[model samples]
Target: MGTAQAATLAASLSRIVADPNDMVSLSDVLRQRQLIARMIEASQGEAPLQQVLNGAVHTAAQGCPAPMAKILEIDRTDDTLVLKSQCGMPAGAIGRTAGKAVEGNPAGEALKNAEPVIDIDVRRRPPESLPDILKDNNVVTSVSLPLINHDGPYGILEVDFPEPTQIGAFHISFLAVVAGVLADNIEKIHARAALIVERDAKAVLLREQQHRIRNNFQLIIAMVQRSVLQTTDDGCRKNLRDIERRVFAMASLYDHLLGLSVQAERADLGRYLSAMAASFDDFYALRTSGIALKIELQFGIDVDLDTCTTVGTIVNELVANSVEHAFGGSEGQITVSMTREADDLCAVTISDNGHGLPAAALESTGLRTVRLMLNGIGGRLDVQTAPERGVKWSILFSDTPPRKRGAAKP
Candidate 1:
């Protein structure tokens, strides 16, 4: 052949080789775009950790024909890599652990150097140098990338082929991108888990503090009762007893708040009202013997701490008055009921089957205190009393309203 003919032949061969290289470059670009799109979709998913791992492995395996794709996270406790998620690997190999030695393992080497490592032929390596899991699975070629970010090395991504396969620079580049996405997702999941732990700790602490406060209030009640017994004057003794009852009423509110399953700024009115009634029954039995007192309580709404306390105080005064004067030291029954009136309004009624109130209403100190408490909490009081029959007191209140008094019952 002449010199001109040989030169022409060389140029044609050069073009032939360049065409496949061009095609391979185009294929890599498309694979990179696909991996990026999958990452974005995975990030938007509800389960961040699962989505990230699955996306990383699926994307890597799709780009390269690998029989198995796995993600191994660094277990900082023991300084080893543990398999976290995998595709096409036996279930037993899911949690397999490997030491941090870079001598024979491609994953360890990649993580140690914060780079990508590819082994085209693993069968040639010494049996001792191969990981038992990989060898058992008959893996012939593998590519590993370190999941490193600004926070440093986190884990490793590995794709294993069952048969001898060649991995190019473009394939390694795709795996590197997948590793970066997985690293970011892992950090976010860890941060969220830490936040949940901190929140639970705070809740436990708050419950303990509330328990202590209730105990302290109980001590105060005991001291007041002691003072009541020590006083010689009838008036002074009665006043001390009243004070004790009011303190007990407040303590009941705290107990009801603590019993709730969920922590909130408000207390349940129904539970608070029921507890207060039970406490009053016990107190009545202890103070006055041989007198039967039956209390019927019904609740239908909930209120906040401040509102519950005010309402409880009012109920305490009303019940005490009925026990002291309504039955005139005889057997009687009292019914305490609460119901929701509107979207934000509620009504509570306390009634007794005994002699009714006197013609003049709001005559005693206890009644006056009830009226004041109701006013303070933006509530209204209504009294229905009949001579020689019975008395019923209904209180209407709103969740959010201006403090005011309603018309007196005639």
Candidate 2:
């Protein structure tokens, strides 16, 4: 390649990763290959040659004029260039590997010499290393660039040119640059994919454990509830009801944990909130007198387990306290609104138009439990009264960064 073409290729190679599509001009590929080769020769310690090869090839075709370009990882053990990944190739041709190395075929020559090979008249099947099936179907000109890693030859890039006449020294040089980039990028992609797979596998195991834990919790709660009911003493009955309250609190937490799928990396915050609110509604309907309640929510915000459980418990305590103390002798309304703040804090406000917070709530054990839960997540709770009206609890809670779950795990 000429100095200008070489310079362009070299510059682009360094910038391959920054490009959104990871492509480069034809001239750019040539310069990159030369530069990379020098870097490989000069470097002594650990170097990322494989990644360089893949990135080079990927960038070479980024904005290419041709319809297809690809990087194939050569498994010398099998004597074939396996198509690891590519851009602009027909889906039917994906995963297909080029035929084994041959002495005279353009691709084979390039691989054998550890260099670039350009075949202008690829339309006619080359005497050697040509797949008969491809030649019969009118296969044409192709340029093959070999990818050499520190370990050995990693892959090859094959660019199918529309016309045999378009192949030239500039094209060959540019393609070489592309080859080095492909080597590097291919390695990175493979490593990243492997990490993702491992993470997904771990998440699946965690979810399965969560499922079993939830089931066992329900079973134990059932047995406890039954045992409590079998007793007739009023004192014992009261104690069981308190036990049932705590168990239900935990049960609600288990319900959310179990609802997560084996593949999920994080809980669905919106769903958990909706379900928790619904549970509050049901609990009131079943336990209280004629007090009717209403709930409204704005969703799509996510939170971690610690924060979610604390929030749920706080809501349980507040709603139950409202229904128990505020309604006096008639019906009332309860409104819940929660939103995520820009600073990653969750803001919650619950309001009811019954008797305001009892003078004793600030000193009550249940209130203390609620306070402790809020404090655990770096949140604060406050009770307010609307002139001669009911009670409202304004709360602020902080949560851990949202984690991915199942298919959502990136």
Candidate 3:
């Protein structure tokens, strides 16, 4: 503004302040406009969208001389202007949705023409018309301004007063500028949040891919070790080979989990357990020798991903041990069953009908792995072994104790 214009605005403000009863002078109006322009510049840099919208609603209603005001956003689903934030309306009338267009309502007219509608009585209009709550709140006249965005009409901003004659041109101008600022802020916030979500999802996928590569590397190590030991005549070397293979198989299963995406605090127990047991088959050529391993699953909803990995690792270790020691230098059958028990617990049992576990094997490293997995899932392990008969190892996990789901028990 020029110096002359600034001087004129100051003079007008002085006149209005001196005579409160008289209509505001041009200079007073210009001063209000200048203040609004300053506020706009101050708000330009950065602010949260919700904060801007709510602040604008409060500013237009309380900071201005106007009696009441609101920022309305269109609900695209319903094609109606719904109040997003408001001040000065009765609490019950704060969030009412304006009726559909038929004729004569200020909001409907503004919406239809994508322009401002000033000095209109909104009580009588189309289908269901104005809500009774608004009428009860003593709103006699309203001005509605459509909030336009890149996609076209977003919503409307409505200001209310006890009578139409009480509203001034300055008040309406200031509200229009405020509405634009609010719309821009909303768009910025929405775009930023969407970008964050997209980035996080991609990061998760990449991590899973890395895990699968690690598992493949472990499998290669186990295969090489098995190949070297199989050509040896020493019984001690064969035993060492079996131990190495089992450890490598365990590590491979952990790697396989990277490729698996378990949704929100829940894991696919069936797939996880199946994947772990299947890893052993990949390491040992048990299938070619007719020693078939079968899996039976009956996991319940409360069994999350953490529980699955723990239980899966335990099952893998037990089955591998059985194949190594119990088969009597020949092929044998292995059965794995999981079923939910009474009292919010899940039980997994691995059984084989071959040479049973001796007392000395109870404290073995393989059994320790089974016990650790069971404890991690808030459960315990019970081993039933009879010499020359068979062995049954059962794991029981309960929901009462909240334990980390995927970590193996110590």
Candidate 4:
């Protein structure tokens, strides 16, 4: 502003004091910009609609001075202005209906005509009964700004000035802008609320489907275990154990899905082994008599689906061999660890602190299959064992494209 106008504004503002109850043009604590800023900041997120409305009413009164403000929601059904939120009004005036659409009601006229309605002087204006808002506060002039936008009419914003001359073109223009901002914010809150409900519904449906899938996995496991126990032949029993292990590992993938909102492409190797190994113990629970093998798995990296299947097969085959043959029914421990060999290559070591593999058991079926799976993944196996000592199998593979490997000499 120019020096002359700045002086004029400063002189006009000098009359007002620091009062939260009154918002005039500009006071030490109250100003138009601050009031509008506070009003615009009153979003309808998480907060109840009534609380948001009340906050906006108080903020609207904040100017370099604020006005005594009230918002009367338009009830279309009853054709009345219901007092919803107010600032600087007597407590009793809240929730009172400002009668219905009538001849002389400024607020009612603003809503009805969808335009601005002004009362030059509420003190001298002739109405049989003054609305509680006007009567209870020192309102000399009042402007009823209809809160409307492209959507529809929301309510009426009643801005009350203590002095009649305070109603200027600037004040009316500012109120009009703030009213639109409030209406837009209300509509946004409604849209977000609807979306939140829809998202919650989808989560419920997903959990239900996951529960059914888990049930199916348990049923399959039960059938495999029954077959393993019923068979007397060692070969048949071993084959059943293999099938049970595969199913157990597959179920681990399902369990992983239960914890997520979306499906994951990469699975944690350590988590999969923990679940599969636990299920493996349950499968042998009835047959094994003496010491159980305690399996401890360390940190594992994320791997794609194919790598998971390959690793799952190799790890289970090794674990099954230890459970069936190692310690010969005596107590022992199996330690599984995965570590980065280099930037692109990784290795998993499964070791059992038990009587080492029998000398006669070189190139067994389990070891042979381990070689085959390693070849498929461009991996190499280094087996360490000694009589009366434990066996450690370290399988190394690259996370990048699998390199070609020659078939092993049996």
Candidate 5:
């Protein structure tokens, strides 16, 4: 590969806990890599930001071979640098506001250039902040590496030496890699905090929105019920009653939702449908006398809100079909079941053991509604009916998106 291509590859590899830049010897590079690998394995994943900062500072002190190492966080609120972690110095000095982190000093120069700035023999050029500590400890050289990434500057990592010395390529590389790792972790911590705040805010708004939605649904049901009572036309009354039942089916879903699902609006499918089924039984208790409504629903099956509503509508329609038309004003049994047939398949079956239905009943408005709702949710229905035999309707749909579609991992 060309030099540009090789450099690009090396830069990408450096992000994986290893930096191959400015290596003076094979041993130096290997030691740097090994120390970084250990540091990452110890501090990765959900570690507190303070703990991570301490780990990075200690690792820098060890690998850079500095007598003292301290990390300062950029306090943008006051345009100051605050000591976060320190090793081989007074531990009580932590949390002290160290310096004005502007573009005048060696530390500020590193932050401004997004690189390392080295100053040796500090007797000639002493730093403004932390002067007493450096003088008492006879510190001579100070190397400052900016803790920065694509999100911009976070802080600075400073490694100071007691004796006058020229820091080598390996030490600078090690400090740079440590600063990069620390900066990345800092970014992740900030992003996670932001998301938590956003989620909490959304949850509050979501609860209020849900309450308003529930109230609206109840108002619609009540209005439909009032219309049912006022209308004298039998056909118009039946249609209005159907509307009331449909609205009730949607409203009653909130009752069976037990706990939180993977998604905010998701719920246990079987429990949700079972609750709706119980409500339906109660709604048609007079017509349902002497008839057994058996529900066999599978728990833990989850789907989105749209799928839940659409499938619930389809299930409600099919169950209503068997409850009203399958029996000739007599008594029988109705079985409603939902099951998971495969990793990505779901089936809902509603069957009834009653006198057979005429072909004209299958072509009624209820079946049309069932078909339409099923189509809306990417599902299909199959029916089996004959004279003296019962009626069975199975609705099948995939629980997962098609392979050709893009999907994110849960």
Candidate 6:
């Protein structure tokens, strides 16, 4: 053959070797002799994996002139060949089995030897040796090809004729090639499915680890709270209480991260703030000294874990500062609001209806800690204060793009 003709023949054979679906057009007997040399040169290429094996069987059957064609997968659990796909076969024959023994039936025989088994005249064979499905369908001649991959035998492909007819060696060889391609594609698809299953298993394991870590933090916070209750010195007790609240804030952040449906790289800012506010309210409620305190929280954005942690610390410091210094041994109210201003910007306002901060209060260690926390999240803090009027702290920061409005609520 000319170089150009040889190349075209090689490409066609490669397509046939890679995909059983391409075999329907490859069974032309007149072209077989001329293409045999090119077929030998065709390299095995990767076939696109299919979700279902029945489609491969149906495609292969379309090329044959036989009266019936079917594919049966080996059921290793029971050592039976269960029919998976079929064309021109009885409805009840689709899922029928070829029994437990591999000696009698053509499908079982082909799978046992990893080769083709041809019965040209089934009537001449012993009646017990014939498959019930085939005998009932009046099949006279049948050819079964084992579908074998690198992993060994998996299934069998069978074609049946109503009348006894001679099948050439070339035709049987072509069918074997089709079976090999189909088996290869099935193996690749099975491998991919196994990988996905393994990945999901690992994700479950990681989530369990995160849950344990959150539980450990809760235990630590409980121990700290017990320490606070045991202290006799008023100053020491107050310091220990502050330590417990800080640890609680860290614990709450972890709880939110673990509860998220997606990866825990970010958190719902509104939800986290609300949770922190609730924790503080519960802690301070027990120290009732006729100080009626009301805390209002409104949130409208989400932030990454780093930003969430920094903002959470800032809130912890600022809110605690307000509770200790804003109310001068009297009843007061604190309102915390978070709103998304734009795609990448958000503002948080924490205000109180109590005695406002003096100029010296801004220079305190608590306010300095809040400033440092804001800086870490690439945020700016602004304080509006006046004596006896009250104090409002406004913090504006860059945030992730806003989620759909009704998607998450605080």
What overall lDDT goes with each candidate model? 0.73, 0.62, 0.64, 0.68, 0.72, 0.69
Task: Return the TM-score for candidate 4, rounded to 2 decimals.
Answer: 0.63
Clashes of 2: 42
Model 2 misplacement above 4 A: 1-78, 81-98, 102-106, 109-145, 148-151, 158-176, 231-243, 253-271, 281-288, 300-304, 322-358, 384-391, 396-410
Candidate 2, residue 35: Cα displacement in angstroms equals 13
The segments of candidate 5 whose C-alpha lies over 4 angstroms from its true place after superposition are: 1-23, 33-55, 86-141, 148-154, 162-165, 168-170, 188-196, 254-267, 285-292, 303-306, 322-333, 341-345, 353-356, 375-378, 384-390, 402-410
Q: For candidate 2, lDDT tens digit of each residue in 75-151?
A: 76877766665555555665676666666565666666666666678656545557542454344777677666545
Among all windows of 10 consecutive residues in model 3, the one with the lowest summed lDDT is: 8-17
Candidate 4 segments whose C-alpha is farther than 4 A from its true place: 1-55, 72-85, 90-105, 122-134, 137-140, 149-151, 162-166, 226-243, 250-280, 286-291, 295-318, 325-331, 336-349, 354-388, 393-410
Model 3 Cα lDDT, one tens digit per residue, 96-133 = 77654324556666666666666555554442566453
lDDT of 4 at 268: 71
Query: Candidate 2 local accuracy as lDDT?
Result: 0.62
lDDT of 4 by residue, 1-410 (tens): 22322322332233333345544444533466666666666653466676667766776676313558888887789888888888887777778887565557778777776667777787775656466556656777887777664444557777787787455555665565556666656555666788888877887887888788878887988998899779999989878878887777667667766765544666676677676666655555613545345555655567666677788778877777777777777777776777787876778888887899876776677677778777776777888998678899887876664333333332
Best by TM-score: 1
Model 5 steric clash pairs: none
- Each candidate structure's TM-score, on Cα atoms with residue i matched to residue i, is 0.77, 0.61, 0.52, 0.63, 0.72, 0.72
C-alpha lDDT of candidate 3 relative to the true structure: 0.64
The C-alpha stretches of model 1 lying farther than 4 A from their native spots are 1-56, 63-65, 101-103, 123-127, 149-151, 166-177, 286-300, 358-378, 399-410
Lowest summed lDDT across 10 adjacent residues in model 4 is found at: 3-12
lDDT over C-alpha atoms for residue 386 of model 1:
92
lDDT of 5 at 253: 66
lDDT of 1 by residue, 1-410 (tens): 32322322232122222224534667668867876786767676445687678777878787775779998877877767888888888777778875453667777776776656678887787777677778877888987777754456667789999988977655665565566556666666777889889988998898898899899889999998888888899999888888877888878887887887546756668778887777775776724634444544445465666788888888887777788788887677777888777887788888888889997766766677677777767777889999878899998887653333343332
Question: 3 or 5: which has the higher TM-score?
Answer: 5
